[model samples]
Target: MIAVWKEWAGEKLNESEWLSLLDLAQRESAEEDALVRGDLPVPPPPVSGHPRVTPPPPAPRHKVPDTPPPRPSTELDDRFGPWLARQLRRSGLTQSDLAMELGLTRAAVSAWVTGRAEPRSEVRRQVAKVLGGVQQFAPLERWKTGAAVLIGVSEYTHLPSVPSIKNNLSALTEVALTGLGIPHSNVHTVENPTSAAQVHEKIDLAMEAADPVSGGLFIYYAGHGWTDPRNGRLLLGLVESNQHKTWTAMEFDRLREQIADSPVGSRLLVLDSCYSGAALDTLSAGLSSASRIEGTYVMTSSNATNASRAPQGDHFTTFSGEIIRSLTDGIQGGPRVIDTDTLFRHVRASCEEQGWPVPSRQIGRDGDRVELMSNRWGQP
Candidate 1:
């Protein structure tokens, strides 16, 4: 709608235009609601004298101007600090007004004007487009590195051991997570968890320690996966699991519940094992579907039926190793900050080429891209 309006008007809508449009919409909505509720209008009191004497003609109202006040000094300026302040003063716009136009916070706009902080390239481009200025934007000095919770169980008491999983966890922590700029202490690892309690406990602690308002969350699991025949739910077998005592394993649905309750705005889940697709299913379910406020990403090594092969001599499982390689090696060719969607496509293509089970991905429509790692070292 905004695009159509911009195209029709031959320019972006200014603050006053946006506010007037909103006010008109709200007034129409209120009238519709009153009509639906069958509220009758009250007539004005009848005139007492001279059977309603004629009144003088009222002055006609004029339409409000569509264009915003023009800015002075229209020459291009690459320095955002001076450019931003000049535009604000010339157009008679406050920092708050510019913030509304840019869909950003007033503090963020203030920081850009005051030289306290710089906007990322994407935001800088948006500012240029909306306010009409120099289009060039420099890369951020530092990116925001997020937190991660990695869980890998290679040894199961009742199931055949998946030895390569341990290596997968190590590579994910040292190579992938660290390469993405996640701090060593912030990357929590749970290896060969003996019971479900330990896995959830570690996850809860990581989520608690993370500051979700600023960064993202990544959860990776590689282990022996199973599907309960009766309920068709997925389970990740733990160290003490057995056929009769199934309480030892971690259920995918339970993990989904936990993730849904997380306060974080961005979450990425990567699983490698048989029946890992069940986790994807749970992610698509009603309770776990991505909301407008938060992004949800799920990537499984294979479908529920296919097995994730771990070649005997390889240090890591075929699927897990490919993922690690994709992150570290592929980072050079891709954007400085690698998002999960792009990384998934690269990994999936490799798997298909190698005759391995193709990975599956579920990305939310409303959710923004979730960054997995930054090619360059970054702060936070």
Candidate 2:
């Protein structure tokens, strides 16, 4: 009967409503079982209703049917306020102490502590930072159900070809499949896209092909990144991209909008291109101005004014090379899964040590817990 309802309800309702309907049915079924088992009291029926419905007949003690429970989907935001309050007390710090540290008013901190106003994702990250602790990673199952778009621009018509791009694409693909455990079918790749239109099409196809229930959407771009001299808007270059002609390249904001609009619960973006770091303001741009419903993590090669390094004779570009290293060599003593921010920290430290362009990073909402790959050596 539930299956029949699901079939009819699914056709009539949206995904969210259908899921809610199923959840309601599941709850009702559980309550009915509890009533039959005498675990709950049957509510008194009213005579004014359309008709009086008979309650379920009692069954044998051992014959109660087993039904799966609904998955826990409650937002963790409700707990954050209390958790922050507790952490502050445990650390023996007053609200003023935190306010000073975060450069906010005491009242603002109090709001967060009292659950009057919730901190945004970035602010939550800062809160975690002020009260320092090791980052906890998400479960490995998240990435196993995730999707990725590996884009490489190796050969350009108006620009010089960076032969290293092909390696970047192939290597990241391997990481996504093996270390990340993402299905090969869900991993999309576009190489040497000829025009900006093609890049847009590829993005559309990726969004269309990605499963609606996908755990996360991971997009990586390794190519020439240009900034519009007129407006300073970062552009992801294509084969036909002209450094001077702004219309020739795909604007970073376009990709940002697309990802923000995606239904995927988590998002991770990796860019190994010059001036890529300028696009880090994606989540803060428009939607929430911008909204991060699930998770958002971005790793960029260099700052807005800096150019990324492509070391000669290296297997991959400098920024992407460190990423490949993290994947192939799982961090020892890390958590069960390698979260995106963890990977970024590892890559940033490595790049800094080598005197290479340090990668820029941003983590918002639950992005810190968004896992990407398995830890070859770590505890659960």
Clashes of each: 0, 1
lDDT of each prediction vs. the true structure? 0.65, 0.70
Give candidate 1's total backbone clashes.
0
Model 2 TM-score is 0.60
In candidate 1, which residue ranges exceed 4 Å CA deviation?
1-145, 243-245, 286-294, 331-333, 366-368, 375-380
Please provide, for model 2 over 69-121, each residue's C-alpha lDDT reduced to its tens digit, 9 standing for 90 to 100.
23312233344465566556654568998899889999999988787897764
lDDT digits (tens) for residues 123-218 of candidate 1: 755664554321111111111345678999888778888788999998888853335556556688999988778878878876775666765677
Write down the TM-score of every candidate: 0.59, 0.60
The candidate that wins on lDDT is 2
Question: RMSD for each model, in Å, please?
Answer: 15.6, 20.5
Clashing pairs in 2: 288-291
Candidate 2's displacement at residue 140, Å, is 3.1
Model 1 score (lDDT):
0.65
Leading candidate by TM-score: 2
**RMSD of model 2, in Å?**
20.5
- Candidate 2 residue 371 Cα shift, in angstroms, is 1.1
